[model samples]
Target: MQWPDLFDDDNVDDDDLSEMTRKYLPDTVVWTTDWTTGSLIEQLERNVFNVDPPFQRRSAWSDTKASLYIESLLLGCPVPPVTLAELPAQGSEGNFQYVVIDGKQRLTTLKRFALDGELKLTGLKVLRDLNGRSYSEVEQEPEFRRFANLPVRTVVLRNWKKDEVLQFVFHRLNTQTTPLSTHELRRALLAGGFTDYLDRESASSEGLQRILGISEPDYRLRDAELLLRAIAFVRYSNRYKGNLKQFLDTITRSANRSWSEPFARELDEVVGSINSAISAVYDIFDKGAFQRIDDEGQPSGRFNRAVFDILVMTFQNETIRRAATADPQAVRSAFTVVNRNPDFKRFISGTTKTPEAVNGRLRIWWKQLSSALELPYESFEQVQTW
Candidate 1:
């Protein structure tokens, strides 16, 4: 029986809305203090502060923006307070006293300018005289002295029990500034055992990185997000509705909070399956794996997330993996043929986050690849789908 294609839009349903509306009151104590840039830099130098927390995004401010911020500090302009979360002291052996929950970019700019000597002031409208001058070159100048002595407000949160509250605070704080990516927000809100696991696996998996075509780690966490997509689909496809973000968010939060020995074992198995699947696909397609094939029957362009999800899941079956391994050409031909299909193309391209498109593409690819490999289509049919 042919599975029905239920076309749907990216509308939020009641369950998702409820999830969004849910609220919690965190048991946190907050206090504010004024610290000079010199003091802050000293603390940073002493490694008393963790600027690169797992939840914080990488430094994203351009040189010009960072210079402007430095100029503002020199001019005594009012700047937003930096928010930090205090790390619990563990027998006087803790490395960091606090983690920067907000203002990482600002702190990073400071470190780059004063400590690293990397940032030369440029595009400074107010302090045009400081342009082309490194911090070391102008440290004796009055402007530099004033900038170092400027008092910046710092807000500190301590005794927070729930990480979710910290996530909420980070989310609320960043809504006014440069918007964060979903994966960035996820990392901030869901930094726990499962997310740590995702990070470790994504970083160590050479085959997965080859397929992703990234040598260095993605600062934006897009690579981790892709792995999460594959994991979610492979493990919880039946639970996925039409909302991809909510599905991923819920699963991530749940997995992090409810992590146990059994769950860890299951994840270990899933990671192995993902690795096996990646190996099988890479054997057949090499670096071109998970990319869309162009009209010339050549794989081209960026890696396709939808294609990655389905292929990784399909190849998880040992039978499919062994068949593809034994007949790489036939598997490659099946991939090209399926990519040429109009319906399959649409299923992978526009509006692919919908349940209809996800399920449709998986079904189509599984059917085609199974037939080409001379395997029973019923094997894929028996697998769960939403």
Candidate 2:
């Protein structure tokens, strides 16, 4: 029993990826770096510095987040350097202005307290003296001018000027420290309809929760990342190059551009496949599988990412899909074989990121299920039965 998949994704060579990724990289200009707090307030007020620029993620700082940075300032601790870019002046658009390429959270914190004086500072671990004081009131205090004059190092890049460059730099900078969650990074770099679809679908998914038995979404977007993993490899397996993170980024980035009715339909098809697979697995497993321990066969609380990959890959295969419709128990039995196979356990526990690992595990799982179901297909790997 063989069915043609939607795409052939068995090979993602370097030559294919090189040309695709190069389109996103921008030409760089000579960068000038400077550490300045001199007239920084003037710069904010002059329409010279734009904190919330287009295509940037929303400034997600709560007052607590804001206070931590301001606290660092008041206590004279050096925070991370802010990265800024100088955009060349557009004649009709406006004067040349600097955009906060990185450090939007910190810069926005500055705007909230130091400039607008809107938020009163609180929870100061070091500067307990200035607790519960806004910058306006604090500036009047004798020792407060020192806090106001504290220099914030800004790394300004001159004419490193392309929107692609800005997007790339912004992605890199934020990914370095206190790194952006997978969804947050995707939303920032690839804001548009398709990501919006992924969000709504991920949130509303009863199937995802039931299969994994998760009560809520992972704050780090691990669940969403796995969902994305299934969607990507199923559709673009051969299209994947070395970096899985960038591969996911590319999927969202391309979706941001090619959005329309047909694209919506395309998304619908993928969602349909994923949801149907989840429902079938639940129908077969009785109590939603994959939590049971290997060898001992006792259920565990923690969710394993590698096992989720195996199950999703199983559903993606045509033979298992047809076989599961007949007896989901047989599919469960195949999972038992997976646990029993020593090499399968090590492979699932190993570096699941590599293409070889990913494809190899899937092939191994398919071999197990194929033998258990006695389904014959051309080119099925000859399995050494456990």
Candidate 3:
């Protein structure tokens, strides 16, 4: 369950990109616009632009970098254009017209300087004379007044057929610069009720956070990703092939769009079941619930994603949850045996994203667990489609 020792290299399979390309591509219109800095700052002040969209990375530039950017603007240096996806206004409630898809750092810097009056230009090689001056200090000056009139280029994506297309575009846009993680792209591309629900649930789930060793919301969205992984496996493991990332991505986008009362209720049940399973694990393994078992029969090492996947998914069954809850020690003992099984360890440690490895280990663990709990043992073929 420990991350396969670094020395234990295995050939992980690639996702089915051909399938993804066919599914994700959709017809969309792209257009360009020029916004003066003064107008853009006004939009920032009025909240017409969503600068801090959930998919964007946090402002990463140091004060020095931000200062350099401001200098570039003042010196009339050409900067990369910002990209935005125009949100539908029907349900927007006058909140925002566009979400920043790229150039968040640059837009944020502009807001800090022009709107917030917080940035003081420094480390300016070209504008050294203005190094220590804030925007307010130079606003009345003729040279600095021209800063507001600077035209910034922006590209907008509109008339998209699906949210997934935006997600795909965002992924492509950031891949060369600051690459977005898979979860980050998902969050950006699928910003509907289901993703929103995941945000709320993952933030509030004490048990899930504790098991995953997170105290606050994970900026990387790892906590949400884990929850999604569990849900995806529980709901669609039978349909999974070797492409773990695409599988999760496809499901997340679909769920986000299709989120409804029934879907929410079903997800709530799954979350509750997961919580029940976590409670049972805590009773037995304590903090070691999702970690590797040591030779001394104690939980050891970091949390294992593979272990978490199979164990939580299995224990989520109501019958299994009850069985483990009734006899925590038996489950614990069964875990020790399963943990030490050479084949099970192999499946978890190396190139474990494939179907053979994923389902193989689940089968092994379930066989041991069912015997330990004295429940009817079901084959993975029968169980996975659930």
Candidate 4:
């Protein structure tokens, strides 16, 4: 059965895939390469049919994966196979165009190594021989040399179209038992330079844990994963499911790569602003004269989403910064006092009217807080709450 047929817009279980595999040889699927390979393929490439644009983001497979596969093939271990569907050209110059509906990462890496020879690995594992042997003994091991010399494999697909590719992706997303997520499909379908950059940034181990307050042990959420979630929430809110992994895999790849440098710089700046806001709050909670702690000695605090949103807006407007710069702790103390009152939630709710209305009121409160804290006052900028 064709890949599209396998994923028939309904939930397809492992049984379906197993049965399909029985009927079809995995290697029998057709795939073809552009005449050129590597970075050249990206540069010289134009959509012949133009029915579907090649996704802007190149494949996200890293050198590490290449290394592992090279090592695996060297060791004679079978790699997981992927599917390629052929397209019958509507009388295009070329006989066919191949759609890598699956196995994008592996195929991309193979193409890269074959064409440009830019070998680098990040996440792949190092394989070792039993009895602590290593492939390092290349002179002694014929198998090692054979493995090291494995050539890149290119499959050819003829007459592919954009809509069909997209529908195939959607169908795959819905039907597979352990289906590629909508985000993953999105990643595969949409192409952009920023995709790989975001994928790499989101994969960082140390940078994320600090940002998300995740730790080594007693783990639940991962810092890297949470960062993806936060970015998704801030950007295309509610357009995709809340699964951060898929969001990172698919959407991150399709983002504009040109925006990466500025995005990172802006991200750091925003994080710094949030830190300042958090510090301001911490100071208020520490005020022994005005506030007391709970039994566990953590601050008796109510850091609701509304307040968090308000804090984020400090980065949004420069006015909020100048207003909170001087004796910022006192500014936090005022809010803490309001929070401690029996009617605090009601007061905030009444003042803002709704969650969406908080930013405007926050700007006003920021002005008041600045005045009380001996900071410069700036009038609130008008914002459309909705």
- For candidate 4, the lDDT comes to 0.42
Candidate 4: misplaced stretches above 4 Å? 1-65, 83-91, 94-102, 120-310, 331-386
Error of 3 at 132 (Å): 14
True-structure RMSD for candidate 4: 12.7
Q: What would the per-residue lDDT of candidate 3 be over residues 231-339, giving only the tens digit for each residue?
A: 8888888878878767887788789878899999988988887777777777777767777676677777567778888888877777677778889889888989987
The model with the greater lDDT, 2 or 4, is: 2
lDDT tens readout by residue for model 2, 1-386 = 11112111211223333443366444565355544443566677666766643322334566766887777776567778787777678679667777666676677777778677877877777767777888877778764555566777778767553344555565566543554444544554456887777766765678776644556544334346556776776676677765666677788778778889998887777767777666766676655354334567543433455566567555644446667769877877777777667767666654556777777777777777777778864324321110
TM-score, each model?
A: 0.67, 0.63, 0.67, 0.38
lDDT of 4 by residue, 191-257 (tens): 4655443345444434343333333310212222333444543344334442323434444554564
Error of 1 at 381 (Å): 3.5
Colliding residue pairs in candidate 2: 9-238
TM-score of 4: 0.38
- Number of the top lDDT candidate: 1
lDDT for model 1 comes to: 0.76
Cα error of candidate 4 at position 36, Å: 19
